[model samples]
Target: MKLILIRHGETEGNLNGIYQGIKDYPLSEEGKLQNLKLKSKLENINVDKVYYSTMERAKKTADAIFDFSSSAIYFEENLSFNEINFGLWDGKDYKYISKNYSEQFQSFIDDFKIFKFPEGESFKDFYNRVSEGIRKIIKVSKEEDNIAIVAHGGTIRVILCELLGFNYEGFYKFNISHGCYSLLTVCKDSAVLEFLNK
Candidate 1:
């Protein structure tokens, strides 16, 4: 079976550098157009099913690509894959965070796994959330199908870690951009990355 992971189109938080966390936010206007362009780009692929995060941005992207025409289109909250809860930092810009809390900002850049944003979650917590969704996908998918998942960048990084056998500390090295795509082929023993950030 093949698994395709796609990050949702840009959000207002993406453009503004705000920590969106698990809060519900719609896609920006440019995001919608980006998703439509992505749909046009992927129109030829034989996608058997489309699965997406319940977050509006992700769902909107999935709808643009698959149009919910196949019964295989599913919105899974588990797949919504929560962002690292930013807590008090949720609405702050990166520049503000870096200037006011230099050490914390450096921790995020230098050692994300250990960076804790006051009341927010650790990277480990976010990793496990994506892991659960991965497990579900592996158990349910047929050998012949190509499954597409529309989720967040954080979620895509976890999928990359699992598929590429990357250690916990290297998660930040994988850069899945907004509206970018990845392809993972799953066999009996392990998963192989075919394409990344395409």
Candidate 2:
């Protein structure tokens, strides 16, 4: 089975370099352009099932690609792969969040293994959520269908690391772009990364 993992197109928060975790922002004009580019790139491939996060950015991007098509599109709350929730820092600027919540944010950056947002879920918790969703998707995959998932950067990284056995420290190395796709081909018990950050 072939799994195509796509990161949603750019958002205002992305261009602004803000921590977008789950703030629910829409795509910017540039993001729309990128999405169309991706659509053009994926044109002839037969995509059986399209799944994405419920967030507007993800949902909208999915709609763009899978729109006016016969494919079954599934939106799942579980697919909303988000970073550690910033709690009190959710909508604030990153610099402000760092300045105000310096110690907590530092710990979070330095040793994410132990640090978490003041009132947010831990990295372990976030990883478990993505893992559960991945297992479910894998179990449901058939021999012929091609699966596409439009998800967040955080989600994509977690899935790649878990499925490919990449070390935790190397998790951020995936470096995916907005609307870019990463391909993974899976068989019974093993999977190989076809292309990453494409």
Candidate 3:
């Protein structure tokens, strides 16, 4: 089985570098250009099912891929892979959030896995959610299944930590740009990373 993990195209929040937890921002015009490039790159690829975040940006990205790729893709909105719920911090600038909630934000910067958001989920909880989703996806993969996932950077980061044998603290260490994708070849025994940020 081959798993294609893609980060959604750019949004205004992304261009502005805000913490867009679940603000439901759609893609910007420039973002659609990025998706078009990705679609051109993935033309005629084989994909069995696509599980994407329910967020608008992710769905739009998925649509672009489905339109370009020749595969008959089955799409499912899995909240399990949604971006981290920033709760009170949603739709706010990171610098602003840092200025306001300096202490809590500092704690998050120190060790995010254990830090709980004032009105949001802890990184630990987010990790568990993604893990559960991956476990199920892996369990149901047939020998020739090819899957795709359109998700946020944070969602893909946690999934990489699980697939690449890394820890949660290193989640932010990886750089996954918008409209980029990572490929993995998986079997019942092992999973191999083919390429990342393509």
Candidate 4:
């Protein structure tokens, strides 16, 4: 099976360097253009299905691909692929979080893998959610099927970590840029990254 992992296009929160988490924000004008370009690039690829986060940005990005595909593709919104819930930090900039929640911020920086955002999910929780989603995708897909996943940076990183056998703490190693797609060749026992941040 082939997996195409895509990060949603930019939003005002992204441009402003804010943590969007589960907050829903529409794509910025620049983001729309970016998705258009991505759509054109993927028009020739034969995609079998598209699984996107429930977030508006992810939905819009998935729509870009589905709308231009030559054949009908199965599409579904999966909440498990949604961005990690940031709790009170949602829509807040790093500066604000550091200033307002200094101790918690420091703890997060010290060991983010175990740090649970106040009123939100821990990294472990997020990883499990994304991993389950990936498991379902793999189980339902045929060996030759090409599956596309449209989600947030964090969500995509978690998926990559799960597939590539990386520790959850190493999720940051992947740089999933907005509107970019990474390809992976996956099997029951092993997975190989074909390309990243493309």
Candidate 5:
């Protein structure tokens, strides 16, 4: 199987460096342009299925591919692919979070792997959810199927980590840019990264 992991185009929150998390935001004008470019890149590929985050940005990005690819059977929206919930931090800028929730912010900076957001998901929980989602997709997909996943940067990074056999601790090591996609070749027992952040 082949996995085309796509990060949705930029949203207003993304351009302004706001923590969007589960808060819904549509693609910005620039983001739409970026998606168009991505669409062109994938215009000729045959995709079996597409799975996207329910967030507006991801939906819009996925729509581009779905609309262009005649081979795409269908696209499904999955909450498991949503960005990590930021809870009270949603829509806040880093400066604001650092100043207002100083202690929590410090703890997050010190050890983010174990830091749970106020009323939001912990990293461990988020990883497990995403892993389960991937497992379900793999379970139903054929070995020759081409699958595309349109999601947030955080979600894409987690998917890459899970599929490429990277430690969760190296999550930030991947530079999943807006409107970019990576390709992975997967088998029953192993996966190989073909390309990244294209």
Candidate 6:
């Protein structure tokens, strides 16, 4: 199975340097243009199945691909591919979180896997969710199938971490640019990373 993971485009939260984990922000004008380019990039590719988050930003990105691709999409937000919920930090900028809650921020920086947001989920929950989602996708798809998934940065990171054998705490070690796509090949015994942050 070949997996194509496409991160959602930029958003107002991104322009303002705010945390957008589940805040429901839409794509910015620049993001729309990015999606246009992304659409053009994948317009001629053959996709067997498409999956996307329910969030508008991701959905819109998937819509662009759908408008140009030859396949329909399946929603994964209600299943296992939604963005990590930043909870109280949603819509807040790094400056605000660091200034108002320095200890929590530092704790998160220290140990992302264990640090729990005030009302948010731990990284473990999200990691497992993404891992399961990818496994399920692979399970349902044939080895020769090409699959596309439009999701958030965190979700993509988790999937890559699991596939690449990186720890969840090191999710920051790699970057997944907005509107960028990555390619992965999964065999019955091994997984190969073709490219990342593309």
- Please name the candidate that would achieve the greatest lDDT relative to the true structure: 4
Quick one: best TM-score, which candidate? Answer: 4
lDDT of each residue in 1-198, candidate 6, tens digit only: 888999988998888998888788778998888888888888777777788877888888888767544335443443478898888998899889999899899999887888777698788888898899888888878998888999998898888888888857568887889988999999975789998866
- Considering only N, C-alpha and C atoms within 3 Å, which residue pairs clash in candidate 2? none
Query: Cα miss at 104, model 5 (Å)?
Result: 0.6
Instruction: Show where candidate 6 strays beyond 4 Å.
Output: 68-78
lDDT of each: 0.77, 0.79, 0.86, 0.89, 0.88, 0.83
**Worst 10-residue lDDT window, candidate 4:** 64-73
Q: Residue 114, candidate 4: how far off, in angstroms?
A: 0.4
Candidate ranking under lDDT, highest first, comes to: 4, 5, 3, 6, 2, 1
lDDT of 4 by residue, 114-190 (tens): 99998998988988999998998899789999999999899889888888889686798988899888999999868
lDDT of 3 by residue, 1-198 (tens): 888999999998888878887787878888899899999888768788889998999999999878535456677899999999998888888889899999988998887879887888888998989988987998987879989999999999988888777868679878988998899888885778899999
Task: Give every collision pair in model 4.
Answer: none
Give TM per candidate: 0.87, 0.91, 0.94, 0.96, 0.96, 0.93
Kindly list the per-residue Cα lDDT of model 5 for residues 2-71, writing each as its tens digit.
9999999889888899999999777899999889999888878788899998888888888875774555
lDDT (10s digit) by residue, model 1, range 126-157: 77777877877778878988888888888788
Question: In candidate 1, which residue pairs get closer than 3 Å at backbone N, Cα or C atoms, i.e. clash?
Answer: none
Model 2 lDDT-worst window of ten: 71-80
Lowest summed-lDDT stretch of 10 residues in model 5? 65-74
RMSD per candidate (Å) reads 2.1, 1.9, 1.8, 1.4, 1.5, 1.9
- Model 4: CA > 4 A from native: 68-71
Higher-lDDT candidate of 1 and 5: 5
